[model samples]
Target chain A: MNRITLEQANAVIAGAFAKAREMALKPLGVAVLDAGGHLIAWQRQDGASTGRLQLAVGKASGALFLGISSRKIGDMAGERPTFLASLAPIAPGGVVPAAGGVIVVDANGHAIGAVGISGDLSDKDEACTLAGIAAAGLTAQA
Target chain B: MNRITLEQANAVIAGAFAKAREMALKPLGVAVLDAGGHLIAWQRQDGASTGRLQLAVGKASGALFLGISSRKIGDMAGERPTFLASLAPIAPGGVVPAAGGVIVVDANGHAIGAVGISGDLSDKDEACTLAGIAAAGLTAQA
Candidate 1:
């Protein structure tokens, strides 16, 4: 898989914010992480909810740790809240099992990194995050 | 150096955030960890200021490394910007080298974990963190 560089991470944030501004949505916070889930770049739009950053990291890290998009966690949670809750201890930090974060796959479809967004509705956050992945020319879905 | 458990870490955060809310402060972000500086758990209040969680992690982790308090760094930085800047990268989490966090310690004063709070002024952030540490029955330098 091609390494996701800081250049790409920065570009994703720039493009996403531009789109968010174009829409005049409330402030947004975005985060980009390496495949290992370490912070690569993050930004909080002026007046954006601060937790947006953590949400971004959590959702992105959750996807990366599980090697799947966060959206799938909800599907598997039918009667397994206890098992799902175990993930937080294993992963450290927090994990949100939903699709607000999208994996950034290399051209070969190998996982490389992820992008996450928060500060809007959950769906809006997911939309902005996908917009970022698309702007980076990466497939956001599994 | 005992490893910090996620449960212990979350306990600190839950307590701190509850107190912060009780005091009518703005929403907050809190992170806890152990001696190795690994993250245990983190939470960002819904309306917290942007970047509060990351800042809190950085502040708390930074204080842990120095065996002092983040307040000391903040005060010293006012007169020693270059020194603090040089120290920022020592932690990969973008430590601000300022006040607002404290290291969690063991009875023998061994560094264990840390908690950082953001979403208010630096002083208030520090106050909240102190409140959290106090809630944990651990001591902190104001």
Candidate 2:
């Protein structure tokens, strides 16, 4: 299966940061994960703290692994606290319900990867991740 | 003006893993950082989970940025959640005020960096980190 390669991930990060700058949002840490939920590429802003990057990777990994957006995961996680708690220990790179993560899809409607962004509000983080997907010639899951 | 060099950080990571192997401890994630709290080097043993890497980096980065060991900083963070919370939005690297990170001191007693070990209990993590520092010909800050 065609996967989101490192090259595409880099482009997405570039696009995400560009979008962040355009929107005048805070510097961000963004992560792109392949369909297998492994990181394809990641970048942390010079000023953004380290936690943002870790969380970004986790959020992206979770979105792709579960084939769901972060907001949806949050809702489900909230419904099952025990499951969520157990889940966190296993998914070092997955943060089920964090904001700023979205699944990447191809034009043909295939799941490709997930993009996670941090260091901004949830909506802004989502916007940046969406921009990244769009930049990679992929579409963000609506 | 003493600060951790990338080489020193890499050495700490390598030494920590070597010690873990020698002791037959669990696979480990090791992180080392400069005084400025940036990633100088990091590594994870093959069998170690991703969470280990994240937590190690978090603890090390937190200690360096806060100018205290994780043992001390964790308490501070717990008590001053708002201060730590405000810092969260600023850096791309994650910082945790948890134990397992140790400040590295050179022969002259100047802090050169910090070593953090994960994939074990907090005490074990600290022990591994100290062992790694010894391997690197350094001392842990008291």
For each candidate in turn, give its C-alpha RMSD to the true structure in angstroms.
Answer: 14.8, 10.6
- The numbered model that scores best in DockQ is 2
Fraction of true inter-chain Cα contacts (below 8 Å) kept per model? 0.00, 0.02
DockQ of each: 0.04, 0.05
Counted clashes in each candidate structure: 6, 13
- For A1-142, candidate 1 gives per-residue lDDT tens digits of 4766655776787778777877667877777776767665566654454366667788888888877766676556556788788887788646786657778887777878888877777777777788777787667755
TM for candidate 2 is: 0.53
List model 2's recovered fraction of native interface contacts, to 2 decimals. 0.02
DockQ for candidate 1, C-alpha atoms: 0.04
Q: How high is the lDDT of residue B15 in model 2?
A: 76
Best by lDDT: 2
Docking class of 1: incorrect
CAPRI verdict on model 2? incorrect
Model 1 over residues B1-142: C-alpha lDDT tens digits?
Answer: 3545434554576678777777788777777655555555555664454466568777877777776677887887899889878985676665666667787666677777777777777787777787777766665543
lDDT of each residue in A1-142, candidate 2, tens digit only = 3678888889999999999999998768888888777877878876454356656766677677677887677666656656555554466464636568898877776787888887776778888888888887877887
